[model samples]
Target chain A: MSGGLAVVGASRRVRAAHYATERPRRPVAALLARRGELAQYDGPRFGEAVFVTLQAIDLTCIRGERMIFSGLTFSVAPGRALLVRGPNGVGKTSLLRLLAGLNAPAVGQVRWAGGSLAGRVSYVGHLDAIKAALTLRENLAFWLAYRGHNRSLAAALDALGIAHLIDMPTRYLSAGQRRRAALAKLLLVDAPVWLLDEPVSSLDGRGIEVFMVALRRHLAEGGVAVLSTHQELAIDEAETLTLGRNP
Target chain B: MMRSLWALLHHDLRISLRQGNASTSVVVFFVLAVTLFPLGVGPEPQVLARIASGVVWAAALLAAMISLDRLFQADFEDGVLEQLCLAPTPLPAAVLAKALAHWLLTGLPLTLIAPVLAMALQMEGAGVVPLILGLALGTPVLSLVGAIGAGLTIGIRRGSVLLSLLVLPLFLPILIFGVGAVEAAINGLSARPHLLILGAMLLAAIVLAPLATAAALRANTE
Candidate 1:
């Protein structure tokens, strides 16, 4: 842990929601679902097998003439989460986008430690990716098919605690509700790595709790997630990375 | 696999269906634009017959162009395009799927309704068959090629005007061949060569436009 984390940790300790005991258990190793045929990107594509760990080594991101962040390094293991905390314009979102493979890093590579699961990253950014004209179920139905291997929407809906909004057109949902709908995608996707940018920004307390449960479920299932937010999520087994000018 | 492509196509169609008025209005614009010709130049059948193919083709071209501005822009704004790019499916395949959706929304309806509009403009007899065939083959190329423009202008402010400027020149080839085929049939000449060129254009657009559109989309997202 770096010095910034200590500062962040001290500040976070004052919050009443911190978990007193973090359950320590070994992370289970299993391939992401839709195995064999569909998960066709499992074998190592680089120097070594890196499927178990997600590592960002000397990563540099530049937007136009400005350097957002550079030489940023972090590695997250299976059944763990990395919380990205920083003030505004600190490249938190840029970092998550890089991890999602949405943008190529200016100088470094985001690699997995066990083996490369090339296409197994789920990214939920600021935009909800919902179709306001369509119902909630309709919006997610497409994702379910795109990811392949049909499963009941109930499980994903239950994960986000939005089962009642299933058939309603998403335009009817409030901002927080819409945010939960986007967060539900983490469950809908069977991918192991999640890159979420400010996922709880619009969520109320209950919505945040809903997100915590879903994220906990994801990490507990041997998945790794990188979440960028201004506030701490108080989830156990999650590491914090603070980006800044003087970190 | 093809499932992802199908899902993209399915999702687009569903969105269009829910926004029922948007898709239908393109066809309505096609109808109204074509109908305006007869009203403008009087009901002189000979004159209407002469310009009928050109007018209908032009209207279909404009209608396709208008609908295209929204094709990728909406998805790009909603973050669906970002999500699609992150998916396992290749970007070119996703572009192909979206182009197909665009064709189904604007091209197919325009093709189906064009003959009625052409006949309404006094374009009777042998010219009608060639017009229908030409449009069926040509309109898909319009959708495919329009995708390139849509992808290019996706993130820019007020990109539709720029989209029109970029695509109108590209659309000239399709218009010339499509209208030529119909005009040839009316003049008792073989329309085969023109329609063949249209088919070739469709095939070429199918191969090249997806790649181009995919590149544009990737660039715009960056």
Candidate 2:
């Protein structure tokens, strides 16, 4: 029994180490890729092409009479991800909300792709952002139409493995399934920057794996994501931005 | 932009229809409220006729109000409203589409049933058309205006009552115009002016109410 307990403890330590190592690699890889792309492009071509850049300039957010955070600053380049971490109620979500332009910052700005973040970035919060009355298929279709994606709904649903639930009302879905359905909306959209708050909250192990894969694919395609999550994510490369503390 | 609006309208209407009981509940409330007048006041045909237009319209407004609180509450709770706010199309336009859908689901049915309830109250046949017309134009305004209240009270624990308090006063003008049109038609006077005013109100709401609603939705959601 003691030996078995030792084995379990070792595994947990290994997993924690793996998790710690996994976070920073994503942004390092992004920087490397940017460097590689820059090398491939001649000087003029690199100079002329526009890349979407996200910069949170000294942001402060207040929620419910409490100051969540202040003087938070960070920037994410295209093809990168910013993993925000903090203690509960420290305002990781509020910071994302401000960065996503859902709410005004008490004092600062979140700029996107060389412009104001407004109308440019997509923000997904903890609440799956799905309508229970509509079928999963109809919900995706409506969001696609609203976002002006002009993409095929079948492909998006298939990507999320929710093609089977296409006709099912969203209220009938399990928590993990509903999160997948919500993630499917992100697939249908083509926004350059994504601000996701606790996106993996209800996802299962397999669901989290699938989400990581999807996110990697998104980054590879030059999309930027800033996600706040407490769970350790296994990504090939990522970076952590701890809020409410100087880094 | 227009396509987004149409899609929002289509999706919301389809959901309301498939939900079955929700649409019926609002209509049933309208009927029950209309039925109570005769029961309470004692069914005298002349007495019913005298108060029928106001009673039916008031009941319809109250029933419509009952359902209005749910317009954005469910979406807000389920996080769908966040996705909507994130859409490329402006949030105000989407909100207008939703308000339009709410009118179609809750307000439109109430308008359709008004004539039947009016007849039960011994309202003159000629007045029924104007009553329906007034409701058609007026209820959308009620929905659009009520959306602002709904948006404001979203996520509040006691939002339903707060929604009623905030919106009922705003609904008074619509109530006055709707009942006035029916009364004008009953008296064989031209109801066109009242109908025109109702249309104007609807147009103004279509333009202004959505902005207010979208702002409120942002505030409440944040």
Candidate 3:
């Protein structure tokens, strides 16, 4: 049984090598023959317009004695989303936090629209900022007021499909519902740049779909979103910026 | 900026009022502390009366300190502190607004209730008015100073004890003058100097403590 398993693994490795080498070299006619095989492969497209930019920046973060990430440089422009993919403990959230201006980068500068992304950005971290004591409507109202948005809270809640939960205290809401409320807060704000740290972490499949739809709307409206996610998001024309792997 | 400050203050006040337990607990603790003093030290009416002003002021300060940890713990846990820091309003203004709201909920009620507690402890009627007034002017300073401690210890695991240890020493002058003012009033002397000094301390803390607390918050976050 062990010998048979080893033989199968070796044959599979050989097949993978052959497929990797020959796939890119096939002509359009040959590719047409493998359309069914390629149908399942979905990834983001590159070379869209530039929305936001981070120059050759050195972000030296020290949580006691560890340097999280250093000399990280990347930029995402309009019509392009930077999907920060990295293993846990690779400072993915720390990078987003730095970009959001919540923590100052030890030695780097992150600029949006040719300037610091201070006032023109919205950040939603891993923790839900909702107050358990306040109803969803009250939480949204407080955030909107804090962001100086004079829009209709009812309309915002309606857009997120959270109008049903508007009067319920956020603590009683499910994880997906809490996430939706937080995303609603991001949408209600009028900022151009969105820094979302694992916005879909606790979301269900339906919740993920709702987020993708909202994100697509934001991208369509010329707003930019940067998020980190472990789950594959099959958004059309989205770009992935893998951190830690390159360095 | 002022609008943001006002909004934060209003929001915090509304939340505290709706919750109702934190402020009530602080007042209840204040009363318990005052009552314990008469019980523990013997209920000689003359002795209680002689020490009533100091007893009430010390109990009020201790009660205020007991609830200082709650001032920022809930907001910090709920991520509201991060939101406040990120708001377009200046950090100092936001911190000042939160501290002011805390004073309104905790300190203001203590001031209102201290007179009754003082009377029960056999305090002179004339001293009771000055006791309330002194607390009115002095407890805000305590709140502001205590906010600095709270901000400094925002994320520390064992922070409440450290916060009291850090703030109580700083609060001695306010307590001294606050109780001193009432004692003078009880003695039929003008308490104007002590009251004015306590007011000055309040004004100074109101101006300075927010800046210190904002800096402390920034340092802690960093």
Best by TM-score: 1
For residues A1-247, what per-residue lDDT tens digits would candidate 2 score against the true structure? 0010100000111111211221232233245356673343222222212224566777777777777677666666556687878788767887787877677888878765335556556677878877787788878888888777698888877777778888998889998899888787778887767788888998888788777877887776656788999999865445677655433
lDDT for each residue of candidate 1 in A29-117, tens digit (9 for 90 to 100) = 34433244214334332221223567787788889998888777767756678888878988888888888888888997886533443
**What is the C-alpha local distance difference test score of each model?**
0.82, 0.78, 0.75
Estimate candidate 2's alpha-carbon lDDT, on a 0 to 1 scale.
0.78
Off by over 4 Å in 1: A1-51, A113-118
Evaluation by TM-score, superior candidate among 1 and 2: 1
**Candidate 2 vs candidate 3: which has greater DockQ?**
2
DockQ of 3: 0.27
| Candidate 3 per-residue lDDT over residues A10-103, each given as its tens digit | 0111111211231132243234235552232222221111213332244565556777766666555454466778788777788788887778
Candidate 3: which pairs clash?
A50-A77, A50-A78, A51-A77, A51-A78
Task: Work out the TM-score per prediction.
Answer: 0.87, 0.86, 0.85
- Residue A242 deviation, candidate 2, in Å? 1.5
Task: For model 1, state the Cα shift of residue B77 in Å.
Answer: 1.7
- Over B1-222, each residue of candidate 3 has an lDDT whose tens digit, in order, gives 666677677778777776778788998899888989878999999999998998889998999999898877887787777767766667888888898898988899999999888889898898977888899999999999999999999889989999989999998998899888998888899888999999989889989999999988877765
Per-residue lDDT of model 1, residues B13-82, tens digit only: 9888878876789998998898888889988999999899999999999998998889988899989999
Model 2 Cα lDDT, one tens digit per residue, B1-222: 898888888988887787776669998988998899999999999999999999988998898899888899888887778777766688999998898888888888888888999999999988989998999999999999999999999999989999999999999999999999999988999999999999999999999999999999998877
Rank candidates by DockQ, best first. 1, 2, 3
